[model samples]
Target: MRFPGKVERHAGRARDCGRHFTKTLRRAALAATCASVVALTGCDDKQQVAAAGPPPAVAVTVMTIASHGAAAQIDLSGRVEPIRTAEVRARVDGIVQKLLYTEGTDVNAGAPLFAIDDSDYRAQLEQANAMLQRALAVQTNAQSVVARFRPLVQRQAVSAQEYEAAVSAQGQAQASVADARAAVTLAKLRLERCVVRAPIAGRVGRALVTEGALVSAASATLLAQINQLSPIFATFPKSNTAILDLMDEARQGGLQLSKDIRFPVQITLANGRAYDETGEVDFADLSIDPATGAQSVRARFQNADRVLLPGQFVTGRFRIGERQDAVLVPSRAVALNAGGASVYVVGADDIAHLRQVVLGDQQQGQWEVRSGLATGERVIVDGWQKIAPEQRVRAVEQHGPGPGP
Candidate 1:
C-alpha cells in the first residue's frame, strides 16, 4: 500500500527505534545492579552494629555483708572537759608585781604563778613582830611581879588584894601574849600568800591581771585559770528512753549487757578523726534531766599527749553490750544526705541499686546496718563514685580495712 522509497524510510525509523529500546534496557540493567549492591552494603553495616552490644561495665570494689557479734552501743554528742578546773583568784589585797610563770604552761601544785607586792606585807610582818616582842616584855614583867608578890603574900608581907591584883595582871599579860602570837602567825600567812601559787597540778591559762594592777581580797579578783589536762572527763547526755530501750533489748536477748558500768568508750573529734586513745565509763546519772528527758553520763580518758582540750565538741560511743548476728559494712560504703543515710548495693546481675539504711554503732571501721539491708548482699565500698544506680558494674571483693578518699 506504500511507495518503495516510503517503505525504505519507515524501515530506517523502525531500526532507530529498536536501537533506542536496546539502550533503555541496558540502562535499566545497570540501575538494578547498583540497587542490589547498595542493599548488600546496608545489610553488612547493620549486622556489624548488631554484633556490638551494650557499653562495657564499670569496675568497682564491693563488700559482702555478713553477720558478726558486735558491741551494742549508744551514741551521743559530748564535750571534752577537765576533770578539775580551778579559777586562780587573788587571795590577798596587793599590787601585781611580777608574773612568775609563762602563760599556757603546765604548773605543779604549789608552784608560784604570780607575785604580788610583798613589801607592804613584809612591813606588816615586822610590825606584828614588834607588837609580839612588847607583849613578851610585858608578860615577863608580869611573871616577875607575880613571883615577887607570891613569896610576900606567903610571908604575909603583901596585902591579899595586892597578891590578887598581881595574879590578874599576869593572866592579862599571858592573854595578850597569846593574841599577839596569833596576829604574828596571821601576818606571816598573809606575807606568804602575796605570791600566788597553783592550788593543783594543771595547765595555767593566760594571766588576767597585768603588772601593777591593783587587786582586792574582799571582791573576787580573778588572776588566772588552771585546768587538769591528763585523765580528763568526757560528759554526754543520753535520752532516758534510750536507757530503757537498752535494758529492754538486753531482756529480749537482743543484747548481752555488761554487768559492770565501766564499759569501753570511744571518741571522734570534730575534725572527723577518731581519737587514738580509749576511755571508760565513769559515771551515769540516775536522775533524768527534767528539761531534756536525758540522763547525763561521764567517761574518763587519759590525755597523756595533751591532744584533747577542754570545751572541744566531740562524738562518743558507749559499748553497752554485745549483739549477735548483726550486719555490718565498711564505713566507706555509707553516704549521707538530706534524704538520709544510704549505700549502693551491687546485685548478682551486676546492677547497682541505691538503698537507704538505718545506721547503728560503728565497729572496727565498719558501720552497723540496722535496717534496709540483708546479709550476703554486696555493698560497694570503693569505686562507688565511678558508677550510678541502675548502671552495670564489675564488682570485685574488697580485702582491706576500708576505702579512702
Candidate 2:
C-alpha cells in the first residue's frame, strides 16, 4: 500500500512538472515575439533616418552687378502753347464789306485781312482835300495883300489902322488853311483804318465775323485768332519746393544754372511717342501761384514742321544731373518688408541672407541703390518667397539672355 501511494505521488509530481515546463515554453515564445517586434521597429527607424537628407534646392533667377551710366531726371507733365498768340478785333465800327483771308490761313504782318465799306470815308477825305485847296488859295491871296499893305504902310500911302486890319485878315486866312490841312490828314488816317490788317505774322484761326455782318468799334466780334508756330512754348507747372531746391543748388555752385540756364527737355506726346525736336528751358516763374502753390516754367522748341499744336497735353522729362558710381539692380530683385526695401544676398555657403537697401530713382526698369548694396553682390530676383534666412540651400547660377546689339 505504501508503494502504490508513493507511485501516485510520483505521477502527480511528474504531471505538475510537465505543466510547469509547458507554461515556461509559452512565456518564452511570447518574449521572443516581443524581441522580434522591437528589432523590426529599430530597423524601420534607421531606414527612415537614412532616407531623410538635406532639403531640395530652390530654383531662382539672379542678376550680376554691372556698372552703367545713370541719369537723374525730373518727370513732369505740361501743355504746348504758341510763343505768341493774339486775338484779332476791329478798331472802328463799320460793315464787313469784304473778306480778304480764308479761314485757317497764314497771314503776314500789315497784310490787309478785311475791308469795310469806305465810300463815306472816301467822300469825307475828298471834302477835306477840297477845303484845304480853297484855304491855300485864300492864303495866297492874303500873302499878296500883306506884301502890298506893308509897302503902302511904309510909304505912308494908307492910314496905319487900315494896314493893321489887312495884316490881321491875312493871319486869319493862314490859320484857316492850317486847320483844313489837319482835317485832311485826320480823314486819311480814318480811311486807312477801314482796311483791317494783321498786326503780326502767324497762322490765322477761323474768322468770327462774316461779310455783311453789322460790326461796331466797341461791340465788334473777334475777327480771328493768330498764333506763332515757330519756336513754340511748352508751359509746365513745377512745385515750389522744387524751385527752391534748384535755387539753393545754384547758389551753392552745385549747378551751373546761371551760366547755362537752359536745360535739355524731352516731350512725350499724347500718343505715347516722343517728339522729334528737343526743347530748352526759356523762362521760370518769379512768383508762386496762390491757387496751386506751383510755379510755371516755359520751355522753347523750334517747330518748323508744325508738329506741335497749341494746348496739346504732353509729358516732359528733364535731366537734372548724373549719378556716378551708382549701384543699380533689377527692379524685381527689390522686396518690400516691414522695415523697408530689402534683397536676398547669396553668401559663400550658398545660403541666402536678407539685406536692407536704400533706393533711388528708377531707370530702364531698374532701381538705383543709394546705399546698403555693393558691387559684385548676387541678388535673388525670383524664388525669393520660397527662401528663408539661415536656411541651407543649393544655388544654381541663372543667366540672362544676351542683350541685342
Give the range of the ten consecutive residues with the poorest summed lDDT in model 1: 396-405
Question: What digit string (tens of lDDT, one per residue) describes model 1 on residues 255-338?
Answer: 898999998998999999989999999899989989999999999999999988999999998887799788888887889788
- For model 2, the superposed segments whose C-alpha errors exceed 4 Å read 1-61, 64-69, 159-165, 245-259, 330-376, 380-405
The lDDT per prediction is 0.90, 0.82
Please give the distance, in angstroms, between residue 299's alpha carbon in candidate 2 and its true position after superposition.
Answer: 0.8
* Candidate 1: segments with Cα more than 4 A from true spot: 1-66, 330-357, 374-405
What TM-score would every model get versus the actual structure? 0.77, 0.71
Candidate 2 displacement at residue 297 in angstroms: 1.7
